[model samples]
Target: MSGQHHVMVVDDEAAARDMVGEYLSLHGFRVTLCDGGPALRRAMATERADLVVLDLDMPGEDGLSVLRDIKRRAPVPVIMLTATAAPTDRIVGLEVGADDYLAKPCELRELLARVRALLRRLAAPAAVPGSAGRTETVRFGTKILDLAAHVLRDDEGRELPLTASEFSLLKAFAENPRRVLSRDRLLDLAGARDPDAFDRAIDVRITRIRRKIEPDPDTPAYIKTVRGAGYMFMPEGETR
Candidate 1:
């Protein structure tokens, strides 16, 4: 499966790109090396990448900007690598839809582990029991969460892009509607528990989900904040 998937590594430094590309290739994964955002965009234009390993500090079009553009164009998972020690920097990466982040000078083994974990999660199916021919869906606001396809579709049936992490989080909410789930519990249910994940990571992910499934993210009707408790999924939206 790793051999069949393509991973793109985008970094301004030749040594950095070569190192990651070589490591992934050795691990039976197809790899592409890009010098910067423009190179990444060109590669993406010609062919699809299953996932992206992007470096935050680049000469032009920083990783955050590149990540925003990539998310706008596709739902491919991205793991950001930043040398910045600031938690705010990592949080900002998450805000722009990064699936995960790693500090610069990261261990190759850890990077490989993260890549495999994310890919596995993306390929894993929701454990919803249903008849073989039937589609499993859950309603969130005006959108339909397609559990089978790992997508959210609007009223007109157009697909709203969702990352693996986002889909997992939404599935957690759908499976336990109306139940208040604390951030810790939510992370456990979503299989998104990361040692480096901050408390606000869940909040950022919820914000992203709301932007897709809520009628108005500012005044969320589907997932409501329970003051200090966490959030509750109101499948019927706000009660009349």
Candidate 2:
């Protein structure tokens, strides 16, 4: 992929949209501005975007709905924006498939950095055959993670769709099994955009991964949340 990517900015504030659009434009992204969800839908209908910078506080069709719609309509990466640093909004955004997020009243430089981080992560090369051996994969329970294929498959060969963040997080966990991974270290090892230690970004991604790999997400076997310490990923047979 080229360094340039098409980004759609959906914000009710015209000034915010213009500013973000122009900033991204100057940074080599082709950007489109949308005033609301309807315009967002129209733009996506016209052409698929590489990423979306969406504001959460839109009228009529809120960003959560738009995020859901985007995932349902297309699986493009999205970065959500909110005016307040509210944990509820951030957590909800992640649950609804936003790839990353930033609080409003943020510096343009920070936003640019986050955009680049996510784009770079998305552009990372997949695992491919290089040696005279089978492609390396890790097994947790009945699910096998094809590191090169970037996919999780079941014993029955059913595929689970993982977002870029989830895939990266699971890879990190598999590589460092039986170790308590702090949220900061997980983000660092996973090549994710660093959020605050208190941010629920890492937790949300972990939850999503558990839902796929665990027989029961509520009480996970592979990925266990260690109270106040972080999380530990159990390697196969460790439980016994």
Candidate 3:
């Protein structure tokens, strides 16, 4: 299964990039190693990678900028490697469209685990929403989330790009409407729970999702925060 997918490792540090590239290669994945942003850009132009392991603390054209560019250019999943201990870097990376992040000097096994989990998600078949069947699409405001297709469509039927993480969260909410779900419960439902995930990771993801599905993200209607509890999915956008 891993043999079919291509993984790209982009880091300024030669040792780190080579280490990851070799490890992934050993695991039967086709791996590409890029020294920096320019190499990454060139590689992306020539071939599509199933996933990217991007280093956040590079010298020029930094990871955040590169992440933004990647999100704008493609829907490929990205996992950021940040050396900074500050939560701000992780938060900003998440906001800029990193599907996930890991601290620097991370364990090789853990990295491989993350890579496998994300690939599984990408390869997983579209789930049938409920036993009733055929009700695959759910509408929130003007946007529509298609469960079977794993894509979000605007009212005009144009596709809006959603990272695997975002789509998983939205699908979780759609499956359990009108129920207040705690952060842990939400992650469990979405199959995205990470031990290293920050407390506000879910909040950041919710904010991002709101921007796409809410008429007014500042005062979200579809996914409402339940104060101390968690969040509730109001399918009808009910105020009361």
Candidate 4:
């Protein structure tokens, strides 16, 4: 990604879309504006966008649905914008693969900070291969994580589709299995900062991961909660 990164701003609100698009353009990003999810889909087909400034509330095919679709089809970094600051909504956004969420009535400065943070994270280097004799595959329950490909798959060999952030978070936990990881630690490892008032967003992501890999998501056998401590990943076997 270059200094003149391309960003797609998806928002139905004309004023809000213009404001964000203009600000990002002024700050050296090449921005393309879209009024709805359909327009966004069209724009994506033509150009590769480095990031997305997505609005949560839209007249049709609302932001959450778009978020899920984007995560599934293309794993681009997204900063979600919503008027409601409800914790449940924020959790859902993060769970479904929004990289960051901002409440509406938000300050431009804060949004800019979040955008920069997300871009920087996406640009981070992948984990390097260790020395000879190091563990290559991480196993938890019936799932296998391939660090190099950044993918998780079940015993049946079905690949679990995960967004970039979710893959990074799972890799962090798999690399340090069976150890309690605090929210702050997980954020640092995932190359993302904790969003405002949504620290439990990590837990939500973990729950989503469990649903894919664990036999029982409600009583997860792989990633276990450690009361107030945080979470611990129980690997099938000890790391060599």
The candidate that achieves the highest lDDT relative to the unseen native structure: 1
**What lDDT tens digits, residue by residue, belong to model 3 across residues 98-168?**
88878899899999998998888767765544535564788877699888788899988999989988887
What does candidate 1 score in Cα RMSD to the true structure?
A: 2.0
- Per-residue alpha-carbon lDDT of model 2 for 1-240, expressed as tens digits? 324688999999999999999998888888889998899999999987988999998888889999999888866788889986667767888888888778896689988887887777767654534523567778866589877677788888777666767777877777678889898787775543534534477887887777778888887888888888888889763662
Question: How do all the candidates rank in terms of lDDT, highest first?
Answer: 1, 3, 2, 4
Going through the candidates in the order shown, the clash numbers are 0, 1, 0, 0
The residue ranges of model 3 lying beyond 4 angstroms of the native Cα positions read: 131-135, 189-197
Q: Give candidate 4's error at residue 130 in angstroms.
A: 2.7
* Candidate closer to the true structure by TM-score (higher is better), 1 or 3: 3
Off by over 4 Å in 2: 126-135, 155-158, 190-199
Q: Against the hidden reference, what TM-scores do the models get?
A: 0.92, 0.84, 0.93, 0.82
Q: Residue 89 lDDT in model 4?
A: 76
Give the runs in model 1 whose Cα sits over 4 Å from its true position: 131-133, 189-197, 238-240
Q: How many pairs of residues collide in model 1?
A: 0
Q: Per-residue lDDT of 1-240 in model 1, one digit per residue for the tens?
A: 798899999999899889999999999999999999889999999999999999999976888889999999999999999999787788898888888888889899999998998888788776565535777888999799988888899989999889878888888888778888898888765543456665788889999999988878999999999988888999879552
Query: What overall lDDT, based on C-alpha atoms, would model 1 receive against the true structure?
Result: 0.87
Candidate 2 displacement at residue 142 in angstroms: 4.3
List RMSD in Å for every model shown.
Answer: 2.0, 3.0, 1.9, 3.4
Which residue pairs in candidate 4 have backbone atoms (N, alpha carbon, C) closer than 3 angstroms, thus clashing?
none
lDDT of 4 by residue, 78-135 (tens): 8898898677777778877887777887788888877887776556544534724453
Find the candidate with the highest TM-score and give its number: 3
